[model samples]
Target chain A: MAAFYSFMAVLALVFIAAIGAGSAGMYTLFGVAIPYVALLVFLAGFIYRIVYWAKSPVPFSIATTGGQQKSLPWIKNSPWDNPYTVTGTVIRMILEVVTFRSLFRNTKIDLRVDNVKVVYGSAKFLWLFALIFHMAFFTILIRHMRLFLDPVPACIQKIEFLDSILQVGIPTLYQTDLLILVGLTFLLLRRIVDVKVNYISLAQDYFPLFLLLGIAISGIYMRYFIKADVISIKELTMGLLSFKPALPEKALETTFFVHLFLVSCLLAYFPFSKLMHLAGVFLSPTRNLPNNTRRQHYTNPWNDPAIKPHSYAAYEDDFREKMIEAGLPVEKEA
Target chain B: MYHAKYIIPALLVFLAVVTFPFWAKGKAVYRVELKLPANQTECIEDTETMRTSHMQILDHWRDKVVREGERVYTNAKGVKYSMSLTNTCMSCHSDKEKFCDKCHNSVGVAPYCWNCHLTTPKGGK
Candidate 1:
C-alpha cells in the first residue's frame, strides 16, 4: 500500500510532464526551471540538516564497534572495524562508505521448519543489492557527463564504452541501466515480502524507490524506444548549467519530459527525505567517529547541544509505582 | 517522531524549489548569437530541424558513412548528397571557430566532434 501511493505520486508527476504541459512549456520547465530549483533546494536543505546535526555534540563517543577494540598489547585487535587511531578510522570510513561494512556483518535469524529451534545465517543479498544500486547509479551519473560536455572528454567516452561493452543491442544497452532496475526491484520487493520490513515500512520509505523506478523506466524508454532529440536535450542541459535556459526549438518526445520531470522531483525531494542519508552517513558519529572513548574524556561540549538522553534514574521514576506493586525495590516507597 | 516546528520553514524551501520555473523566468536574460554559415543559402536539413536534430542527423551520418560505408543521405525532402562532413557540411561553413563555437560555448556544451574533426584549422586550410 505504501509502495502503491508512492507509485501513484510519481505517476501524477509523469502525467503532468507528459500530458498537461505543452512540449515547449514542459521543455522549459523540466529542462530548466525544475533542475535549477531542485539543485538549490538540495544544497540548501542538505547544509541546513548537516548544520543541525553538527550543532548537537555527542557527550559520549557512542561509536558502535563490531570487532575487537585497541586494548592490551598482547591481544590482537580488529583495527579496521573498531578504530582507535586516525588511520584506522580512515580505513573504516572508506570501507563503510564504499562497501557498507557494518551492514555486511548483519546476520539474519530464521526459525527452522523441522524443529522449533531458531537458526542464524548470512544474508548478503541486501548488501549486494545496495552495493550494486549505488555503484551503478554513480557510474550512470558520471556517464551523463558526455551529454553536458562539448568535445566530450575521453574519460566519459571510456566510461560509456565500459558501460555498454556487452553491446547486446543496436544502440548498445548500458549495463548500469539494467543493474539499477534490478537493484530497485529487489529493494521494493523486500519492503513488500519481508515480514519485519513490511511491518515497519511507511509511505516515506517506499516513495524514493518508486520515484527512482519511474525515472529509470522513463529514461530507458527515451534511450531505447523513442530516441528523443539528443541535441535538444544537450541544449536544454547546457542552457541550465549556463543559466540561460531557452525553450528547445525542436520538440523532444513526451517520454523524455517524463524522465526529466521525475528526476527533478527526486532532486527536490532528496534533501528533505530519507535520501538525505547520502550526507548524514558521512556525519553520523556511529560510523564516522573513531572508537577511542576508552582513551579520551568527551564531556558534553555545549550544555544544550544534545538533549540529555534518559538515564537509569529517570527510567526508575516512571516505573516506580509498578515496581512497588510488583514487590520490587521502589524509589522513595512510591 | 521528529520536531514539528521546522515543518513550515522546510516546506517553504520545498515550495520555492519545486515552483522555480514560475519564479526563475526573466530574472537573468542570456542571449546566444549564431554565426550564420558564411557561404550557404541552405543547410542539409530544414532550419527548424537543424536547430533541434542537427546532432541526431550528424550521428546518423557518422554511423552510416563512417562506420557502414554508406556515402549517400537522402533527407526528408528527398535530396540525395554525398555523406562526407568535410566535403559537404564544413565545405561552406569552413569558419568553424566563428560558426560552430558561437552556439556551443553559449550553451556551455562540449561536442566531441571537434576532437576528431580537428576544427578544420585557421586560415581556411
Candidate 2:
C-alpha cells in the first residue's frame, strides 16, 4: 500500500510540474482523460471493497453496542446507549452518523495542580471541527457545480451568492474556501503538535494535509495572481462534455492548467486512498446494518449436515449397557 | 493490560493507513492550444468611422498589446466575448464592426491588433 501511495504521489508531482509549465496537451490528458479513468477505477475499487466486506462471514453478533439494551418494562434499561431493539438501533445510528455522538462524548485527561485535579468535561471540539470541515468542503463542491452546467442551477447560484455575501472584494471571496483551508490547516497542525499524535504520525498522515495545502495554495495563486482564462477553460470543458474536441485559440492560461492538473491528480489518487472512505462509509455494515437481529433471525449460510446429534434420549439409549454395567439409574433399564 | 501493547501498534497501523492517500502523487499537465484557420483573416477597411468586430478584438488581445490612454480590462462581458468568438468569425472584421459589437454587446477588443492578430484583419467583413 505504501508503495502504491508513493508511486501515485510521484505521478501527482509530475502533473503538477506539467501544469506549472503551461502545456495544454498534457493538461487535457490530465484534466479530462485521467479524471474519467479515475472515476471508473474509483467506482470499481469501491464496489469490490464493499462486496468483499459484505461477503465476509460474521458468525456472531459483534455490533458495538453503547446504548441501552432492550429489557422488560419492569426493569430499568439504557435505550440511547445500549439499544437492543430495531427502533433504538435506528435512532442510535442516526445520532452516531449525523451528530457524531461518540466524538461528542469524547473526554481528554489533563494532569493539573500536581496531579490532584480531576474534572470530567466534554471534548466536542474535534466533532465540531470535523463537521465544519466536511460541511464547508461539501458546500464548496456544490458551489462549483455552476462551472459544469450550461445554465447554472438556481440552488447553486443562490449558494454561490450566499457564500460571497460578505463581499470582501472584486469577484467575492468564498467563505467556504477560507473555512476549509483554515480547518485543514488546524487539523494538520493538530496531528503534528500533539505529542501522542506526532509519535504515531507517519509520512502518510502528512501527505494528505500537504497535498490539500498544495491545492489551496495553487487555488489562491490562480484567483489572486495568475488570473486564469476561465472563458477558454470553460469552452474546452463544455466541448469535452459534448464529446467535441474543438481546441479554442488562446483560450487557456497558465494558471488554469495548474488548477486542472491538481484536480486530475486528486481524481486519479482517489480510489487507492483513504479518500475512498466517501464510498466505503456507506457500505459499512456496522453503520448500515439494522440492530433488530434479536427479534429477527439470520440463518447461517455455512451450516453443514455431517455432525451427529447428541440429544438426551440418544445419549440414554447409547449408554444403557454401560449404565446397567455400572449400576447407574436409567429410564430404559430392564 | 494484556491488550495495551497490541493496541498501541494497532492504532499506529490504523493511523498510517489513514494517511496513505496523501503520499500518492500522479502526473498531470495543463496544456493550452491556439487553433487558427490555415488562411489568415484580417480587418482593414479605410474609412475613418470604420469599426472592428468582437472576433477581431480577440485576435488583437491574443497577441497581448496595449495602447496609449484607452485600456481594455477583463470582465464578465469579456467572458461572453470569448464565448461568442467560438461560434462566429465575422463579428471582428473591421473597426465599425468591432466598435459596434463592443458597444452594443458590452465588451471591447482592440483595433490596432490586426497587424498581428490575424494574417488578414484587412478583408472579409
Candidate 3:
C-alpha cells in the first residue's frame, strides 16, 4: 500500500510537469523558478535541521561500543570499534561515514533447518546496494556540473569520459546510469519482497525511493531515447546558474521538464524526510561520541549548578527524634 | 550547541561545495556558437533533428559502412551520399575546430571519432 501510494505520487508529479511544460508551455515556471525555489528550500532546510539536532543536549557518553574498551594496560582494546580517545573516535567516525561500517556489520536472524535454533546470517546485500546507489548518485550529481559550469572543468570532462568509456550506444550510455537504476530496483524490491522489511516500511520510506526512481528514469529517457537538445538544456541551466533566467530559443521537450521537476521535488523534500540522514549521520551521538566514560567524567548538559547535593548523615540527623518516637532505628542519638 | 566549533565549519563547507558552480563561474556568461555551414540552407535532415540526433546518425553511418560494407545513404529527398564523416559531413562544415569543437567543448563531450578520423577532410578538400 505504501509503495503503491508513492508510485502514484511520482506519477502525479510527472503529469504535473507534463501538463505545465508541455500543454501550458510554462517553461519559466518549471525550468527556472521552481528549481531556484527548491534549491533555496533545500539549503535553508538542511542547515536548519542540522542546527536543530545540534541544539539537543546529549547528556551522556552514549557511544555504542562493539569491542573491548580502554582498560588495564595488559588488556588489548579495539580502538576503532570502542574508541576511548579523540583521535581513535575521529578515525572511527571517518570509517563509519566513508565505508558505512555499521551497515557493513548488519546481520539477519534465521531459523535453523530443524526449527530448534536461531542462526545469525550476514546480510551484506543491503549494504552493497545502498553503497552502489549512493556512489552512483554522487557521481551523477558531479557529472551534472557539466550543464551548469561554463568552460567545464577538466575533472568533469575526465569523469564523463570514464563514465561513458564503454561507449555502448550512439550517444554513449553511462555506467553510473545503469548502476543507479539497478541499485534502486534492488532496494525497492527488498522492501517489497522481504516480509520483515515490508512490515516496517512506511509511506515516507517508499516515497523517496519512488521519487528517485522517477527522476533517474526520466533523465535516462531524455538522454537516450528522446535525445533532448543538450546544448539548449545547458543554456537553460547556465542561465539559471548565472541568475540571468532566460529560456532557450529552442523549445525543450516535456521529458526535460519532468526530469527537472522531479529533481526539484527531491531537493525540496530532502531535509524534511529520512534523506536528512545525509546530515544526521554526522550528528549521531552513538557514532560520533568517544567511549571514554570509564576514564573521564561526563557532565550532563541538563545539570543545574544551583542544585546542592544533600548528605544521608544530615538527613538522619534531622529525622532522629521523629525516628525514635516512631520506634525506628536511628543512625545517631538525638 | 556544544559542538558549534565542528558543526559550523562543516555546514560552511557543505554550503561551499553545493554552491560551487555559482561562485566558480563568477560574472561569466557562457554560450556555444557553432559556425553553420556557409551557403547551405538545408541539412540532410531538419535543423531540429540534426541538432539533437546528429551523433546517432553519425554512429549509424559508421556501423553501416564498417560492419555491413555499405557506403551509400539515401536521404528522404532521394539524394545519394557516401556514408562517410570525413568525405560527407565535414565537406560543407569543413572547419572542424570552429563548427564541431565549439559546441562539443562547451558541453564537455569528447567524441572519440577524431581519434581515428582526420580532423580535416581527406586530401584537404
Candidate 4:
C-alpha cells in the first residue's frame, strides 16, 4: 500500500508538471521559480538539520566496534573496524562513506536442514545495488554540471567522455544512465520482495525510490526518445545559474519539464526525508567516532556541576539520629 | 555544535562545491550562436528536427551506408542525396568552426566525425 501510494504520488507529480508546465505553458513557474525555491529550501533545510544534529551532544564513545579493541601490546587489533585513534577513525569513516563498509558487512539468517539448523549468509546484493545507485547518481549529478557551467570544464568533459565511451547509441548511451535504472529497480524490488524489509518499510522508504525512478525515467526518455534540444536546455540551466532566467524561444519537450520538476521535488523533499543520509552518514557516531572508551574519559553532557555526590560518611552523618530513633544499626555510638 | 571545527569547514566545502558554477563563471553569460551557411536556405531537414535529431539521422545514414551498402538518402520532399558526411552535409556546413563547433564546443560535445572525415574550410569546394 505504501509503495502504491508512493507510485501514485510520483505519477501525480508527472501529471502536474505535464499540465502545469507543458500544457499551460507556465514556463516561468516550472523552469525558473520552482527550481530556485527548491534550491533555497534544500540548502536552508539541509543546514538546519545538520546544525540541529551537531548541537545534540553525543556524550559517549559509542562506536560500534566489530573487532578487537586497542589493548595489550601483544594483542592484535582491527584498526579499520575498531579504530582507537583519530587517524584510524578517519580511515574508517572514509571506508564507510566511500564503500558503505557496514552495509557490505550485512548478513541474513536462514533456517535450514528441516528447520533444525540456522545459517548466516552474506547479503551483498543490497550493498552492490546501493553502491551502483549512489555512484551512478553522483556521476550523473557531476555530468549535469555541463549544462550549468558555461564553457564546460575539461574535467567534466572527461567524465562525459568516460561515461559515453561505449558510443552505442546516437546520443552516445551513458553507462551510468542504465546502471541507475537497474540499481533503483533492484532496490525497490528488495523492499517489495523481502517480507522483513516490506514489513518495516514506510511511505518514506518507497517514495524517494519512486521519485528517483520517475526522474531517471523521464530524463532517459527525454534524452533517448524525445531528443530534447540540448542547446536550449543548457541555455535555460545557464540562465538559472546566472540568476537571469529565461525560457528558450522554442518550446521544450514535456519530458524535460517532467524531469526538471521531479528534480525540483527531490531537492525540496531531500533535507526532511531519508535522503539526508547523505549528510547524516558523515556525522554518524558509530562510523565517525573512535573506539577508545577505555583509553579516554568521556564526560556526559547532561551531568550537572551543582549536583555534588554525597560520600557514605556524610550520608550516615545526616541520618544518624533517624537511624538511632528507628533502632537501626549506626556506624558511630550516639 | 560539538565539533564546529570539523563540521563547519565540511559544510563550507559542501556549499562551495555546490555553488561552484556561480563563482566560477561570475557575471559571465554566454550564448551559443551558430553561423548558418549564407547560400543555403534550408538544410536536409527542418530546423527543429535538425537541432534535435541531426546526430540520429547521421548515425542512421552511417549504418545504412556502411552495413547495408546503401548510399542514397531520400528526404521527405523526395529529394535524393548521397549518404556522404563530407560530400553532402559538409558541402553546405563547410565552416566546421562556425556552424558545428559553436554549439558543440559550448555544450562540450566532441563529435568523432572529424576524427576520420576531413573538415571542409569556410568556402565550398
Candidate 5:
C-alpha cells in the first residue's frame, strides 16, 4: 500500500512535469517559479517550526542515556551516552550529528541458533545506510556549486575533480552518485522486504524514499544518458540566482524538468513532513540537553507556586505579645 | 483581540515573506542582452544549439585539439573549419569585449579564456 501511494506520487509529479513542459510549453515556469516557491516554503516553514520548538519550554534534564550515569566519585560514567557536563553534551551532539552514535548503539533481540534462547545483537545496516546517504547527499550538493558559481570556487572545483577522478567514461563518474543510489536502494528494500519494518512503515515513510529515489534516478539519467548542456543550465541557474529567469532554449529536457520538479517537491515537503528531522534533531531535548539531574535542580516555570505563611512583619504583629511575654527576640512591638 | 494580536501579525509576516517573489519579478527591468557577432552570415551551429551547448562544444574542441592534435571541426551542416579560436571565431567576430563580455558579465561568469587568448593588443587593458 505504501509503495502504491509512493508510486502514485512519483507518477503524479512526472505527469505534471510532462503536461506542464510538454503540452503547455511552460519550462520556465516549472523550472524557475516552482523552485522559487519551494525554496520559500522550505525556509519559511523551517524557521517557523524551529521558532515554535524554541518557544516550548523544557523544564527537565531528560537527556536519554543508553549506559551508566555520573554519580559517586568512584562510579564510571558513560560520558557520550549520558553526558553530565556541557562539554560532554556537545561531544555527544557531535557524535550524534557526525557518526549517528545512538543509531550505532542500536540493538535487536533474535532467536539463537539453538532455538532455545534469544540473543541480543547489533543491527548496523540502517545506521550505515543513513550515514552514507546523508554524507553523499551533502557532498553532491556542495559539488553542484560549480553550476551556481561561475569561475567556480577552487574548493568546489577540487571536490568536483576528486569526485570524478576515476574517469571511466567521457565525463567521469562520481562515487557519491553510486553511493546514494545504493543507500536509497538499501533503505527502500529494507522497508519492503523486512516484515517488521514493512509492517510499521506508512505511506508517509515510503513517499519520501520513493520521491528521493526518483530525484536521484532522474539526475543520474541527466548526467549519464542525455548529457544536458551544462552552460545553458548554468545560465538558467545564474538567472535564478540573479533574479532574472529566462529559459535557455532547448537546454532543459523533460528529464531535467523531472529532476527539478521532484527536487522542488522534496524541498516543499521537507518542512511540513517528518523530514523536519533534519532540523528537529538539533532541538531534541533528549539529544541536546545535559543529563545532570543529580547535581542541578529544575523547576517548571509554568507550574503555580504553593500557598505560603504570613510575612515577617505580620508575624511580628501577631506574636508581639507572645514574644513580650516570653522575652524572645522580636522585630517590632505592636 | 485574537484577530489583532495573533492572526494579524502572523498574516502580516506571511504577507511580507510572500511579497519577495513579486519584488524580484518587478525589479529585473534591465536583463542581459547579447550583441550579435558581426560579419558572419551564419554560425557553425543553430542559434538554439549555440545558445545551449557552446560551452560543451568548445571544451570538446579544446581537448581534442590539445590532446589528440586534431585541428579540423566538421559542423552538422558538413562544413569544415580549422579548430582555432583566435583564427576561426575571432576572424569573424573581432569584438570579444563588446559581444562576449556583455553576456559573461551579466551572468557573473568570469571565464579564464581571455587569459590565454589575446583579446586586446599586448600590454593594453
Candidate 6:
C-alpha cells in the first residue's frame, strides 16, 4: 500500500506539473483516458478479488462473534450481538453496514489522568466522518450526474433543485459540495491531530485527503471566485463526452484548466488508490454471501488428484489391533 | 452460527469495493430557459436597442443566475419572464473580447471565461 501510494503521489505531482505547463493534450490523455482505463481496471480487478475470496475454502466455522450464540431459545440468548442463525445474522449485518455499530462501540484510552476512568464514550467519529464523507461525496457525485446524462433523471433534478433550495448565493448553494469539503477537512484534521493515528497514518492517507481538498477548493474557486465561462466549460465537457474534442471558441480559462486538472488527477489516481474502494465494495464476499453454510454444507467442487482421507475405518484398520491390545473400546477388534 | 455472525459483515465491508461504479452517478446537466420581455424588446431596435436592452436585462440576469430560482422582471411589452440576457448579451457581445471587456472592465470582474475560445472572429477587429 505504501509503495502504491508513493507511486500515486509522484504520478500526481507529474500530472499536476503537466497541467501547470498548459499541455491540454497531456491533460486530456492523463485525465480523460487514464480515468476510463482506471475505472475498467478497478471494476475487473475488484470482481476478480471478490470472486477469489468467495472461492476460497473456509473448512472451519470461523465467524467472529462478540456475543452469545443461539444454542437454545429457552436458555439465555443475545440474538443481535451473537447471531447463531442466518436471520439473526442479517439483522447484525444491517446494523454493521448502516450504522457502523461496531465502530460506534470502539473505545480508546488516554493517560491524561493518573487514576483515569476508562472513557467509554462513543468513538465512532472516524466512522461517522467516513459515512459523512462517503455520503456527501456520492451526493455530490450523483448531483454531478447532470453533466453526463441527457435528460437528467427526475431524482437527480429533484436532488439538484433541493440542494440549492436555500438560495444562498449568486448560484444555488450546493450543500453537498460544502459537506464534502467539510467532511474531507475533518478526516484530514483527525489524522493530523490524533498522535497515534498520525503516527500510523502514511502519506497515502494524507495524499488523497490533500488531493481531494485541492480538487474541492479549486472547484469552489471556479464556481464562486474565478467566475469561469459556464457555456464554454459545458461545451468542452460535452464535446469530450462525445469523443469530438473541440476546444470551444473560448472554451476554458486558466481556472477551468486548474479545476479540470485536479479532477483528472483524481480520476487517474482512483484505480491504484484506496478510492478503488468504490469498486471494492461490491466484490466483497462477506457482504454478498448468505451465512447458510451450516444449514447446507458447502463442499469444494474443484477436482484434485491429491486425496488422503483419514476415515474411521482406515484408522481402525491401522490402529484397532493396538487398541484391542490396550483393551480400548473399538467397533471391531483386530 | 459462527459463520453468520462475523464473516458476513467483514465480507460486506470487503466487498464495498465492488458496489460503487455500477451505481456511480456521473455528471448531470440541467436546462433553464432565460426569457426576454416583449416590451423591452420593442423598445430596443438594432445594435443600440440590443445594447441598451441587454444592459437592463443583464442586471436582471446577473441577480437571478447568482441567486438561483429568484426571478427578475423587465417591463418588455409589460410582461415578465426569466431574463433573456443570453440572446441579447450574445447578440452584440458575440465578439467576446471587445464586448465582454467593456462590461467586465466596469464591473471589475476579470472572469476567466474566455481562455479556451476565440475572442474575435478569425482576424475580424
Give the top-scoring candidate (lDDT).
Answer: 3
List the candidate numbers ranked by lDDT, top first. 3, 4, 5, 1, 6, 2
Docking class of 3: medium
Residues B40-124, candidate 3, lDDT per residue (tens digit)? 8788877878877889889999889999999998887899889988878888888899898998988899998888888666454
Tell me the deviation in Å of residue A139 in model 6. Answer: 0.3
Complex DockQ per candidate: 0.10, 0.03, 0.69, 0.65, 0.07, 0.06
Q: Write the per-residue lDDT of candidate 6 for residues A151-233, one digit (tens) a residue.
A: 45677777776777676654445787888888888888787788878778887777888777766777787766656655455
- TM-scores, each model vs. reference: 0.70, 0.62, 0.94, 0.94, 0.72, 0.64
Candidate 2 residue-wise lDDT, A1-334, digit = tens: 3324644674577466565446535655655576567555655665555456555655555556665456667887767566666676677667776677777777766767788997667777777877777778778667655444444456776787788878664335778878888887777777767776667766566666666666666676665555554545555655555555445566465555566656656666666677766655544456544555677775454555566547987998988899989989898765
Candidate 4 residues B27-84, lDDT tens each? 4566778778889999888887888888989989989999999999988888999998
Expressed as tens digits, the lDDT of each residue in A1-334 for candidate 4 is 9999999999999999999987798889999999999999999999999999999998787899989989999999999999999999999988988998899989998889999899999999999999999999999999988887877889999999999999988899999999999999999999999998999999999999999999999999988888888888987887888788888887888889899999999999999999999999999988888888887887777779898889978888999999899998988876
For all candidates, the clash counts are 7, 51, 0, 0, 0, 48
TM-score of 3: 0.94
Query: Model 3: per-residue lDDT, tens digit, A1-334?
Result: 9999999999999999999999999999999999999999999999999999999999887999989998999999999999998899899988887788898999998889799799999999999998899989999999999888888889999999999999899789999999999999999999999999999999999999999999999999988898888889988888888889889998999999999999999999999999999999889999888899877898898999897767988888888888899998877887
Angstrom error of the Cα, residue B19, model 2: value is 27
What is the C-alpha local distance difference test score of each model? Answer: 0.75, 0.55, 0.90, 0.90, 0.76, 0.58
User: How much is the lDDT of residue A219 in candidate 5?
Assistant: 85
Candidate 2, residue A101: the lDDT equals: 74
The true-versus-predicted C-alpha distance at residue A170 of model 6, in Å, is 1.6
- Tens digits of per-residue lDDT for model 5, A1-334: 9888888988899889878876778887898999999988987887677667766777666799867989888998899889889899889988899998888877877888789798999999989999988898888887776666554567876777677777655446789999999999999998999888899999889999889889888888887777765566766776787777878864468877888899899999988888988767777889987888878876664556775547888878888998989988887655
Flag the better candidate by lDDT, 1 or 2: 1
Better of 2 and 6 by lDDT: 6
